[model samples]
Structure formats: structure tokens, C-alpha cells
Target: MEEEECLSHSSPSTDNSLELRLQRVTAENIKTVRILVSSIFPVSYSDKFYQECMNNELTGVVIRNGEAIAIVAVKPENFETGRVLYIRSFGVHPRHREAGLGSFLMDFVDEKGKLLKLPHAMLHVQTSNKTAIEFYKNRGFNVDCLVPQYYQRCSPPDAFIMRKPFH
Candidate 1:
């Protein structure tokens, strides 16, 4: 994505009042990203995870009104055939749901994958999270496999590896 491209969203009080933009994660916004992830997911991330976010070229946050309302952190991984974009963390703030922010971040991921010439994008989601499963499926992801007890502390603990192949 361009360094300063803006996404305009309409508001009840004013037309296109909310301005959103994708920005790289930095020391200044690291805490905000940690909080955003905690609020959206049931998992706790390590300091190393946040540290890696700062260095990953594909990691970014969606800032709206100068606050981070969404995030998509990704990295490349080698599977059996080739390297794939591994979506480490991706979510929009609960309050911002259904506003197309999720899709916006996803489109960003797709563009990055194509630019990098990755064969596929993959992520794991809790099997119980039907909403997320449906969302990924709608974006052309399929369950590659079931990982039992993928999460140590989460109830049901199982996860499904969802993958979207780039054609």
C-alpha cells in the first residue's frame, strides 16, 4: 500500500468524516496494537511477537482518526511446495465490525501477496469461531487441516488451518 493512502468512511454527522489509512507498526504504536489484539482475540502474545511486528515489511495497522482500529501482521513461511504468506494476526476493532474494515485489510494482504509472488496465504482460526471461518471462506480460504489442541488455554483448543491460494 502507498505510504499515505486514505480510506474515507461516511459518518452520520458528516460525509466522509472518518479517515482511515494503513501504516507500519512502530515503537510508538506497538502498545496500541497489543491492546487491539487482546481486545479482539482470546490469546496473549509475547514481547517477541510485538518486536517482530516492527520489523516485518507486511505488518501494518489501520488508523482511523489517528487511533488504530484494525491490524494485519504477516510473515513468509516455507511449506512443502514453496513460501506462503502466513497471516499472524488480523482483526478489526469490535466497534468497527461490518464497516468493511476487515475486507479492507484483507485486500491489503492480497495485494502484498501478489507483489511478493507468494503461492498462498494461510492462518489458523479456532474451530468455534464460525464468524471468522465464514469470513475467511468468503475471501476464498479453505480449511487445509485441523490442528487439535492448537491453543493451550482456550476451550475446545482445536484450530483449522485456513488457506487461500493465489492464482
Candidate 2:
């Protein structure tokens, strides 16, 4: 089935409010995703990044009261270790932080990873982003290694490759 069709059939596990729903990214809502990303993260993404989000089944947004409040976009990639789910971008809007949206979106990713049998989930977190690092660690992820200058335009470009093995 098409990813968008799959999304239309499935329902959010916890959210029963009609005003709050999860939807897959599409050409129509891609703009909203970009705007939300810009507001939450300091980095700018490439055109290819946004394109992947619209085409991939693992990319999605949390809509609350007609606005995207969180996003989790991922892709499956072949690593030296094997197939892994790479989180390309993930963030909850600043206004929605500390309201459990981050954890909720993460749980959504974990479910997607398992459904795809990806075996592991990986993402990069800026070394200076202590909150994100702690959040990943709390979700059973470990700092796999430091990648110096991973980010080109961000301050303290260094990043840590965090991974969670959950086969």
C-alpha cells in the first residue's frame, strides 16, 4: 500500500482528541513541516531532505489545532553494521516542549523502526545540545562516537552519533 494510504488507515495510539492528529507529510503540508523545523532547530535543511520526507513512509507530523507541533522524519540506510533507521530530523515546537510531545514522537519512531525490522535507530545530536543528548540517552540510546564538524553552519559543529540497538 502507498505510505499515505497506510497512514490514512492507521490511527494514533494515544490521541483521541479530534483536534490533535498525526499525518504523513505530503506536498500540501510540506511547507508547514519546513516552517516548524525552522522554528525548532537552528540548522537549515537541504532541498533533498524535504523531498525525502515527502516520499518516505517514516516521515510524519503531529497536528494540533490545525498546526504542526512536532515532526519526526527518518530513512532506512545500510550501515557497516547493517540496516538501520536513521533519524534525519526530529523536533517538537518550542511552545510544545516539556509537554511529552518529544517522547510521544520518539515512541512513534520506535514503532516504525520495529515494523520495518531495521534492527537499530541512529541519529546525530550536536554536542552542545545537552538536552537532546540526555533525551536520547534516556530513550535507551548511547553515544556511539563523536563526529567532529558534522554540522557545517551550526556553532560548535561537532556532533555525537547516538544509536539504539533494538532488534
Candidate 3:
């Protein structure tokens, strides 16, 4: 993916009042990213996980009115002539929901993965989060399987392994 061109778009919202800019971020943009994403997640991650995401190279931050309102972090790999793009975490600020920020990030992920020649993008979402499940399903992601106790720390413990084939 072209780092400089990664700002997918910055069009105005439905009413053309606010502009949402999707910018690709590196390890240096960690502070705001961590704060924005942390506020959206229902559960808190360990410092190590946050640190990894902060230090992760493949991450995007959505900015609105000069503040970050959404983020999507990823870990990508190429193996055996096939490429895989994994979504580490995706979250949009509660106040920013329904503004299509999440959709933008999801679409960005798909586009980025395909551009990177990754045939598939994968992720695990908590089973109890029906909203997230529906959001992903509407975007062509299918539940590959159920991971029992996938989140050892979360109360629900179960997760849905979702995948979207881009090739």
C-alpha cells in the first residue's frame, strides 16, 4: 500500500457538515491512536497489546475536527505464495457511530489488503457483539468458525472467526 496515498478520503458527512479524513499512521502516531481506540473498546487491553498496536506499522487513524475518532490496526504477512491481512483491532468512538467512520475503515482495510495482494483478510470478534457481527457480515465477511474461550479475559470468552476473501 502507498503510505502517502493511504488517506483514503476526506469527504464531507451526509449533510456535508463534518469532514472525516482517513490517514495511514505509523508507530509515531501512537498516543492519540491509543487514546481514541481505548475509549471505544468495551474492555481494556494489557499495556503490551496497546504497546504493540502503538508500535504496529500497519495502522490507520480517522480524524474528525482535528481529533482521532476511529482506528484500525493490522498485522500482515506473506506465506507460501499467499498473503494474509489480519485485523488486530477496529473501533470507532461511541459519539461518532453511524457517521460511516467504521464503514470507511472497513472498506479501507479491504481495499488496502487487495492492493497489497493479500487474497484474504481475517479477524476475530467477540460473539456477544452483535453490532460488530452484523457490520462485518454486511461487508461480505463470513464466520469461518467459532473460537471457544478465545478471549480468556473476556467474560463471554467465545469469539467468531471472520474472513473476507478479496481475490
Local accuracy of candidate 3 as per-residue lDDT tens digits, 1-167: 22322465455565476666667554545566667867877667677766665433466777655467888877786544356898887988888888788887887687778777778888889999999999999998999899898886787989998888986
Candidate 2 regions with alpha-carbon error over 4 angstroms: 1-20
TM-score for candidate 3: 0.80
Q: Model 2 scores what on Cα lDDT? A: 0.80
Runs of candidate 1 exceeding 4 Å displacement: 1-15
**Ten consecutive residues with minimal summed lDDT in candidate 1?**
6-15
Model-by-model lDDT, in order?
A: 0.81, 0.80, 0.75
Q: Write one digit per residue (lDDT tens) for candidate 1, span 1-167.
A: 22433323212312266544677777666677778889998988888888888845688787655567798888889877578999999998998888778887887788788988998999989999999999999999999999999999998899999999988
Q: After superposition, how far is residue 37 of candidate 1 from its true place, in Å?
A: 1.1
Q: What is the lDDT, from 0 to 100, of the residue 149 in candidate 3? A: 87
Clashing residue pairs for model 1: none
lDDT per residue (tens digit) for residues 44-154 in model 2:
988988887775668878866556788888888888777899998899898888767788778777888888888899999999999999988999999999999999999
Candidate numbers sorted by TM-score from highest down: 1, 2, 3
Candidate 3: pairs in clash: none
The TM-score of predicted model 2 comes to 0.86
TM-score of each: 0.87, 0.86, 0.80
- The C-alpha stretches of model 3 lying farther than 4 A from their native spots are 1-12, 26-29, 46-57, 78-83
